[model samples]
Target: MGDVEIRPARSEEYAAAGEVTVRAYDVDGHLAGDVGYDTVLRDVARRAEQAEVLVAVDGAGEVVGTVTVVLPGSDFAEISRPGELEFRMLAVAPTARGRGIGEALTKAVLDRARTLGIPKVVLSSLEGMRGAHRLYERLGFARLPERDWRPFPHISLIAYQIDV
Candidate 1:
C-alpha cells in the first residue's frame, strides 16, 4: 500500500487490470492446462459490474495488482455464506511480485468486509497455489478441508477462511 493506491478499479483501467491478472496467473503456471479460464480472468469489466473489483495502481498509474471481492449475493460468491465475504481472482503482476501488493489487496478485502459488518471471509484457491496459501495463512486464514471441492474434472479447489 506504500506508493501504490488500492481502490475500486476505474473503468478506463479495466483492460490493464485484466491483463495483469491474466499475466500473473499464466506466469505462475496456473493456466497451463486448458480451458478458457483466461477469458474469465480478462473480463475485468464484467467482474466490476457483478462484484467489487479492486486494483493496486503504482505511482506511475499502472495496474500492478487486482482482486475481486464477492459479497454474499454476488454471482462471484462461490463459497461465501450469508454473513461472510469472499475474495477471488487475486493477481499481482509478475513484475510486481515481492512488493506486498497481493497482501495489501487481501487486507483491503478484509477491511471491506469489516466495514460492511461481515464477520468472516472465505475463499477458494487452486490446490497448487502455494504462494497464495501462504499469504492467506499469514493473514490468519485457516484451511477448511471439509469445504474443499472439485469444480471441474481436472480442477480441485481448496478452501480457506478467517474471522474478520
Candidate 2:
C-alpha cells in the first residue's frame, strides 16, 4: 500500500507472477478458467527464458502484477516489428487494481524501450478491455487497427502502438 516497484521477475517468482496474470485475466473475463491459456500465463519461467518477465511488488514485498516483454523476433513477438518492443500478458491482480501498479509496470516497459533506443512499443489486447485500453491511451498509445487481427476465429486482438 506504500510504494510499488516494477522490475524483472526472479526465477523463483515466475509461478507467482503467472498466477497474477491469470487472476487479472479471469477477473476481466478475457480468458478466465481457460486452462490452455492459463497454463501459458503460468509458464512465466518459460517466458523468462525466452523474453522478459516483469513483476510489480508492493511495499510489503507482495507480487501484485506482471507483464511479459518480448523482443522483436522472440517467439512471443506477436505484433512487434523491427525497431519495436512488444509486451503482452499485462495483468494486475484483481485485488490490486486501481493502485497504479499496472501503469507502473507498463511504464517500466516503455522506459526499457527508451533505454534500448527502440523506436516504438506495441501490444495486442482483447476487445472490450476498456480499462486496459484507457491505460494504453493515457500513455500515448494509438489504436493500430490496420494491425489488429484475430489469431483464431474465436479470439480477437486489437493492436496499439506508441513511439518511444
Candidate 3:
C-alpha cells in the first residue's frame, strides 16, 4: 500500500477493473447467484461510457480498486437527483485490503461531487456490507433510511447521503 493514485480508469484497464469489482463481491459472498448482476459487474467498459469510472492504483501501477461515479440521470444512478451525484460498484481487491484503497476511491467520488458543485452525494450499499457502512459513515455519509430499497426480493440496499 504505497502511493495509491486515484484517477479515472484508462480504457485498457476496464477489464481488470471489472475483475476487481466482481472478485471483491465474490470473495465477500455478495455475488449471490445473480447472473445478470454478476455480468454487470464485469462490464466496466460499458459503465465507463455512462459514468466516471475511477480506480485506485498502487505504487506499482496496479489497479487495486474501482468505483463508478454516476450523475443524476446516468443508468447506474439510483438515489441521486438534481444537484446530487451517486457512486456505485465500489470494490477493492481482497489482497489490497487494509491499504485504504476503498476509502481513497470513495474520496475520489466525493471530490468529483465537490468539483461539479453538487449539493449532495448519494449511494446504496448492500445491507450485509457492514465494513463498507463503517467506511461510509466515517466519511460523513449519513443513512437515508427513506431511500432504502430492494432490487431483488431478498437483497436490501440501504441508502446513504452527505451534503457536499
TM-score of each: 0.98, 0.96, 0.97
Number of clashing pairs per prediction, in order: 0, 0, 0
Report the number of the highest-lDDT candidate. Answer: 1
Model 1 lDDT at residue 61: 96
- Candidate models: Cα lDDT each: 0.94, 0.90, 0.92
Q: Which parts of model 3 have CA positions greater than 4 angstroms off? A: none
Model 1 worst lDDT run, 10 consecutive residues:
72-81
Error of 1 at 105 (Å): 0.4
Task: Please list all clashing residue pairs in model 1, or write none if there are none.
Answer: none
lDDT, candidate 2, 1-164, per-residue tens: 35888889988888789899888888889885344898888899899989989999888888899999999889899999999999999999999998888889899999999999998999999987889999999999999999999888788899999998
Candidates in descending TM-score order: 1, 3, 2
Which residues of candidate 2, in runs, are more than 4 Å off? 32-35
lDDT, candidate 2, at 88: 95
Candidate 3: residue pairs that collide: none
Off by over 4 Å in 1: none
